[model samples]
Target: MKNIIIFGLFFLMVSCKSNPVTKLDNKTEVGLKGNWELTSVSYPNSSYIKINSFGIADSQCFETSSWRFISNNNQGEMALRKAGCPTFSSDITWYVNQEGNLVLKFVGADVKAKTVKEGYVLKVANLTENAFQLFDTVDVAGKTITLVYQFNRIK
Candidate 1:
Protein backbone atom coordinates (compact mmCIF):
# COMPACT_ATOMS: atom_id res chain seq x y z
CA MET A 1 0.00 0.00 0.00
CA LYS A 2 2.93 2.37 0.72
CA ASN A 3 4.40 1.66 -2.71
CA ILE A 4 1.03 2.33 -4.33
CA ILE A 5 0.74 5.71 -2.54
CA ILE A 6 4.25 6.69 -3.53
CA PHE A 7 3.59 5.79 -7.18
CA GLY A 8 0.34 7.77 -7.12
CA LEU A 9 2.10 10.82 -5.70
CA PHE A 10 4.84 10.53 -8.26
CA PHE A 11 2.31 10.30 -11.07
CA LEU A 12 0.44 13.29 -9.70
CA MET A 13 3.58 15.37 -9.45
CA VAL A 14 4.66 14.47 -12.98
CA SER A 15 1.22 15.25 -14.35
CA CYS A 16 1.15 18.62 -12.62
CA LYS A 17 4.40 19.64 -14.30
CA SER A 18 3.54 18.27 -17.73
CA ASN A 19 2.54 21.56 -19.25
CA PRO A 20 4.07 24.82 -18.17
CA VAL A 21 1.89 27.88 -17.97
CA THR A 22 2.56 30.53 -20.55
CA LYS A 23 1.42 34.09 -19.90
CA LEU A 24 1.72 36.16 -23.08
CA ASP A 25 0.52 39.43 -21.53
CA ASN A 26 -2.61 39.75 -23.60
CA LYS A 27 -3.26 43.21 -22.21
CA THR A 28 -0.01 44.49 -23.63
CA GLU A 29 -0.60 42.73 -26.91
CA VAL A 30 -4.02 44.24 -27.20
CA GLY A 31 -2.70 47.66 -26.36
CA LEU A 32 -0.19 47.38 -29.23
CA LYS A 33 -2.88 46.79 -31.83
CA GLY A 34 -3.10 50.09 -33.56
CA ASN A 35 -1.32 52.69 -35.62
CA TRP A 36 1.88 54.13 -34.22
CA GLU A 37 4.69 56.36 -35.34
CA LEU A 38 8.36 55.94 -34.69
CA THR A 39 9.10 59.27 -33.14
CA SER A 40 12.72 58.73 -32.26
CA VAL A 41 15.56 56.23 -32.42
CA SER A 42 18.17 56.82 -29.79
CA TYR A 43 20.94 55.25 -27.81
CA PRO A 44 23.20 56.07 -24.90
CA ASN A 45 26.86 57.31 -24.89
CA SER A 46 26.54 59.11 -28.23
CA SER A 47 23.96 60.35 -30.70
CA TYR A 48 26.04 60.46 -33.88
CA ILE A 49 27.11 56.84 -34.04
CA LYS A 50 26.34 55.49 -37.49
CA ILE A 51 24.38 52.28 -37.62
CA ASN A 52 21.56 50.74 -39.60
CA SER A 53 18.22 50.23 -37.89
CA PHE A 54 16.47 46.91 -38.51
CA GLY A 55 19.11 46.11 -41.11
CA ILE A 56 16.93 47.86 -43.71
CA ALA A 57 17.53 51.54 -43.24
CA ASP A 58 19.89 53.97 -41.59
CA SER A 59 19.23 54.81 -37.99
CA GLN A 60 17.92 58.21 -39.01
CA CYS A 61 15.60 56.75 -41.61
CA PHE A 62 13.41 55.10 -39.02
CA GLU A 63 12.56 58.34 -37.38
CA THR A 64 9.02 59.49 -38.14
CA SER A 65 8.18 56.17 -39.79
CA SER A 66 4.57 54.95 -39.69
CA TRP A 67 3.59 51.55 -38.40
CA ARG A 68 0.35 49.58 -38.09
CA PHE A 69 -0.22 46.48 -36.05
CA ILE A 70 -3.22 44.20 -36.24
CA SER A 71 -3.41 42.06 -33.16
CA ASN A 72 -6.03 39.61 -34.37
CA ASN A 73 -3.71 38.11 -36.94
CA ASN A 74 -0.33 39.37 -35.76
CA GLN A 75 0.25 41.11 -39.10
CA GLY A 76 1.52 44.63 -39.54
CA GLU A 77 3.12 47.11 -41.88
CA MET A 78 5.82 49.71 -41.56
CA ALA A 79 6.22 52.54 -44.01
CA LEU A 80 9.22 54.79 -44.38
CA ARG A 81 8.10 58.26 -45.29
CA LYS A 82 10.98 60.37 -44.17
CA ALA A 83 12.14 62.99 -46.63
CA GLY A 84 15.17 62.12 -48.78
CA CYS A 85 14.96 58.53 -47.60
CA PRO A 86 13.80 55.62 -49.71
CA THR A 87 10.02 55.39 -49.71
CA PHE A 88 9.00 51.82 -49.00
CA SER A 89 6.68 49.58 -47.05
CA SER A 90 6.91 45.99 -45.92
CA ASP A 91 4.48 43.45 -44.47
CA ILE A 92 5.52 42.08 -41.13
CA THR A 93 4.39 39.35 -38.77
CA TRP A 94 4.92 39.99 -35.11
CA TYR A 95 3.96 38.64 -31.71
CA VAL A 96 4.90 39.18 -28.11
CA ASN A 97 6.32 35.96 -26.78
CA GLN A 98 6.09 34.76 -23.21
CA GLU A 99 9.53 36.18 -22.55
CA GLY A 100 8.21 39.68 -23.44
CA ASN A 101 10.37 39.81 -26.55
CA LEU A 102 8.82 41.03 -29.75
CA VAL A 103 9.54 38.70 -32.63
CA LEU A 104 9.24 40.40 -36.00
CA LYS A 105 9.46 38.73 -39.38
CA PHE A 106 9.10 40.74 -42.54
CA VAL A 107 7.12 39.11 -45.30
CA GLY A 108 7.29 39.63 -49.03
CA ALA A 109 5.00 38.69 -51.92
CA ASP A 110 3.17 35.81 -50.25
CA VAL A 111 6.39 34.45 -48.82
CA LYS A 112 6.19 32.05 -45.90
CA ALA A 113 7.66 33.34 -42.69
CA LYS A 114 8.88 29.92 -41.55
CA THR A 115 10.95 29.61 -44.68
CA VAL A 116 12.62 32.94 -44.09
CA LYS A 117 15.48 32.87 -41.63
CA GLU A 118 15.86 36.61 -41.20
CA GLY A 119 14.03 38.34 -38.39
CA TYR A 120 14.49 40.87 -35.60
CA VAL A 121 13.93 40.23 -31.92
CA LEU A 122 13.52 43.30 -29.79
CA LYS A 123 12.74 43.56 -26.12
CA VAL A 124 9.56 45.49 -25.37
CA ALA A 125 9.75 48.12 -22.71
CA ASN A 126 7.73 50.90 -21.07
CA LEU A 127 4.58 49.89 -22.88
CA THR A 128 1.69 52.26 -22.42
CA GLU A 129 -1.42 53.13 -24.34
CA ASN A 130 0.16 56.19 -25.83
CA ALA A 131 3.83 55.32 -26.00
CA PHE A 132 6.13 52.32 -26.01
CA GLN A 133 9.68 51.38 -26.80
CA LEU A 134 11.57 48.55 -28.35
CA PHE A 135 15.17 47.92 -27.34
CA ASP A 136 17.80 46.15 -29.38
CA THR A 137 21.41 45.47 -28.51
CA VAL A 138 24.13 45.10 -31.10
CA ASP A 139 27.89 44.81 -31.04
CA VAL A 140 29.84 47.62 -32.66
CA ALA A 141 33.61 48.11 -32.32
CA GLY A 142 33.70 45.43 -29.63
CA LYS A 143 31.20 47.34 -27.51
CA THR A 144 27.57 46.45 -26.86
CA ILE A 145 25.24 49.25 -27.85
CA THR A 146 21.55 49.45 -27.10
CA LEU A 147 19.22 51.01 -29.64
CA VAL A 148 15.91 52.37 -28.45
CA TYR A 149 13.00 52.78 -30.81
CA GLN A 150 10.37 55.03 -29.28
CA PHE A 151 6.86 54.90 -30.66
CA ASN A 152 3.81 56.97 -30.02
CA ARG A 153 0.37 55.65 -30.77
CA ILE A 154 -1.44 57.67 -33.38
CA LYS A 155 -4.86 58.82 -32.28
Candidate 2:
Protein backbone atom coordinates (compact mmCIF):
# COMPACT_ATOMS: atom_id res chain seq x y z
CA MET A 1 0.00 0.00 0.00
CA LYS A 2 2.87 2.46 0.84
CA ASN A 3 4.63 1.66 -2.48
CA ILE A 4 1.35 2.31 -4.38
CA ILE A 5 0.92 5.63 -2.51
CA ILE A 6 4.49 6.68 -3.39
CA PHE A 7 3.89 5.87 -7.10
CA GLY A 8 0.62 7.86 -7.09
CA LEU A 9 2.37 10.88 -5.48
CA PHE A 10 5.16 10.68 -8.06
CA PHE A 11 2.60 10.52 -10.83
CA LEU A 12 0.75 13.53 -9.44
CA MET A 13 3.97 15.55 -9.11
CA VAL A 14 4.98 14.71 -12.68
CA SER A 15 1.52 15.62 -13.95
CA CYS A 16 1.71 18.98 -12.13
CA LYS A 17 4.96 19.94 -13.87
CA SER A 18 4.61 23.03 -16.05
CA ASN A 19 4.82 22.52 -19.78
CA PRO A 20 6.09 25.10 -22.23
CA VAL A 21 3.60 26.54 -24.69
CA THR A 22 4.18 25.83 -28.37
CA LYS A 23 3.94 28.70 -30.82
CA LEU A 24 2.31 28.27 -34.20
CA ASP A 25 4.68 27.81 -37.13
CA ASN A 26 2.71 29.76 -39.70
CA LYS A 27 2.76 33.44 -38.60
CA THR A 28 2.94 35.52 -41.77
CA GLU A 29 0.42 38.10 -40.59
CA VAL A 30 2.10 38.31 -37.19
CA GLY A 31 5.48 38.84 -38.87
CA LEU A 32 5.14 42.64 -38.86
CA LYS A 33 5.38 42.98 -35.08
CA GLY A 34 8.68 44.86 -34.76
CA ASN A 35 10.30 48.13 -35.83
CA TRP A 36 11.98 48.58 -39.23
CA GLU A 37 14.43 51.09 -40.68
CA LEU A 38 14.77 52.45 -44.19
CA THR A 39 17.91 51.26 -45.93
CA SER A 40 17.63 51.69 -49.71
CA VAL A 41 14.89 52.89 -52.05
CA SER A 42 14.61 52.73 -55.83
CA TYR A 43 12.07 54.07 -58.28
CA PRO A 44 13.01 51.96 -61.29
CA ASN A 45 11.19 53.96 -63.92
CA SER A 46 11.56 57.43 -62.43
CA SER A 47 13.72 60.02 -64.19
CA TYR A 48 16.00 60.55 -61.16
CA ILE A 49 15.89 59.93 -57.40
CA LYS A 50 17.96 60.42 -54.26
CA ILE A 51 17.96 59.23 -50.62
CA ASN A 52 19.40 61.49 -47.97
CA SER A 53 19.44 61.73 -44.15
CA PHE A 54 15.96 63.25 -44.23
CA GLY A 55 13.97 60.98 -46.57
CA ILE A 56 13.88 60.73 -50.37
CA ALA A 57 14.10 63.17 -53.25
CA ASP A 58 12.81 62.70 -56.77
CA SER A 59 14.24 64.23 -59.97
CA GLN A 60 15.71 67.13 -57.94
CA CYS A 61 12.14 68.35 -57.74
CA PHE A 62 10.66 67.00 -54.45
CA GLU A 63 12.09 66.06 -51.04
CA THR A 64 10.46 64.33 -48.05
CA SER A 65 11.27 63.11 -44.51
CA SER A 66 10.00 62.09 -41.06
CA TRP A 67 8.59 58.73 -42.09
CA ARG A 68 6.46 56.49 -39.87
CA PHE A 69 4.90 53.08 -40.54
CA ILE A 70 2.07 51.25 -38.77
CA SER A 71 0.17 48.04 -39.45
CA ASN A 72 -2.95 46.38 -38.00
CA ASN A 73 -5.69 43.96 -39.13
CA ASN A 74 -3.80 43.16 -42.36
CA GLN A 75 -3.93 46.88 -43.21
CA GLY A 76 -0.97 49.23 -42.94
CA GLU A 77 -0.19 52.92 -43.27
CA MET A 78 3.00 54.82 -44.01
CA ALA A 79 3.22 58.54 -43.24
CA LEU A 80 5.93 60.98 -44.12
CA ARG A 81 6.76 64.64 -43.47
CA LYS A 82 8.35 66.48 -46.37
CA ALA A 83 11.21 68.84 -45.72
CA GLY A 84 12.99 71.47 -47.87
CA CYS A 85 10.78 73.53 -50.22
CA PRO A 86 7.02 73.02 -50.61
CA THR A 87 6.61 71.28 -47.27
CA PHE A 88 3.74 68.88 -46.55
CA SER A 89 2.70 65.57 -44.98
CA SER A 90 1.44 62.44 -46.78
CA ASP A 91 -0.25 59.27 -45.55
CA ILE A 92 -0.51 56.13 -47.67
CA THR A 93 -2.82 53.28 -46.69
CA TRP A 94 -1.27 49.89 -47.40
CA TYR A 95 -2.31 46.24 -47.31
CA VAL A 96 -1.05 42.74 -48.05
CA ASN A 97 -2.27 41.53 -51.42
CA GLN A 98 -3.36 37.97 -52.21
CA GLU A 99 -0.05 37.37 -54.00
CA GLY A 100 1.83 38.16 -50.78
CA ASN A 101 2.52 41.68 -52.04
CA LEU A 102 2.13 45.03 -50.30
CA VAL A 103 -0.35 47.43 -51.89
CA LEU A 104 -0.44 51.15 -51.17
CA LYS A 105 -3.42 53.50 -51.42
CA PHE A 106 -2.65 57.20 -51.57
CA VAL A 107 -4.80 58.83 -48.92
CA GLY A 108 -5.19 62.61 -48.98
CA ALA A 109 -3.36 64.67 -46.39
CA ASP A 110 -3.37 68.28 -45.12
CA VAL A 111 -3.30 71.55 -47.12
CA LYS A 112 0.27 71.15 -48.38
CA ALA A 113 -0.32 67.60 -49.45
CA LYS A 114 0.21 66.34 -53.01
CA THR A 115 -3.00 64.74 -54.14
CA VAL A 116 -2.22 61.31 -55.67
CA LYS A 117 -4.83 59.99 -58.05
CA GLU A 118 -3.74 56.34 -58.06
CA GLY A 119 -1.91 53.77 -55.89
CA TYR A 120 1.15 51.45 -55.90
CA VAL A 121 1.93 47.79 -55.23
CA LEU A 122 5.06 46.23 -53.75
CA LYS A 123 6.43 42.81 -52.80
CA VAL A 124 8.98 41.50 -50.31
CA ALA A 125 12.08 40.51 -52.22
CA ASN A 126 14.29 39.74 -49.25
CA LEU A 127 13.66 39.55 -45.50
CA THR A 128 16.41 39.00 -42.98
CA GLU A 129 17.23 39.47 -39.31
CA ASN A 130 18.19 43.09 -39.85
CA ALA A 131 16.93 44.07 -43.31
CA PHE A 132 14.20 43.63 -45.90
CA GLN A 133 13.24 44.77 -49.41
CA LEU A 134 9.89 45.86 -50.81
CA PHE A 135 9.05 45.84 -54.52
CA ASP A 136 6.67 48.57 -55.66
CA THR A 137 5.70 50.88 -58.48
CA VAL A 138 4.96 54.61 -58.72
CA ASP A 139 2.73 55.99 -61.44
CA VAL A 140 4.32 59.11 -62.91
CA ALA A 141 1.35 60.26 -65.01
CA GLY A 142 -0.05 57.25 -66.89
CA LYS A 143 3.15 55.22 -66.78
CA THR A 144 3.69 52.19 -64.48
CA ILE A 145 6.92 52.74 -62.58
CA THR A 146 8.44 49.84 -60.58
CA LEU A 147 10.35 50.38 -57.37
CA VAL A 148 12.07 48.52 -54.56
CA TYR A 149 12.46 49.94 -51.08
CA GLN A 150 14.84 48.20 -48.72
CA PHE A 151 14.65 48.53 -44.96
CA ASN A 152 16.61 47.38 -41.94
CA ARG A 153 15.35 46.43 -38.48
CA ILE A 154 15.69 49.17 -35.86
CA LYS A 155 17.78 47.91 -32.99
RMSD of each: 4.6, 13.3
Candidate 2: regions farther than 4 A off = 1-26, 43-69, 74-88, 109-117, 137-146
Give the runs in model 1 whose Cα sits over 4 Å from its true position.
1-23
Question: What's the TM-score of each model vs. the native?
Answer: 0.82, 0.48
| For model 1, the run of ten residues with the poorest summed lDDT | 18-27
Q: Write the per-residue lDDT of candidate 1 for residues 68-120, one digit (tens) a residue.
A: 99988888999999998888789898888878888898887779878879999
- Candidate 2 lDDT over 1-155, as tens digits, reads 99999999999999999997533222433454355655545675344543221233342222222234455543333434334434444555555544666555546544222355565556765666666677655555677666666666666
> Candidate 2 versus the native: TM-score?
0.48
In Å, residue 18's CA in model 2 sits off its true spot by 45
Instruction: Compare the candidates by TM-score and give the number of the best one.
Output: 1
- Candidate 1: clashing pairs of residues: none
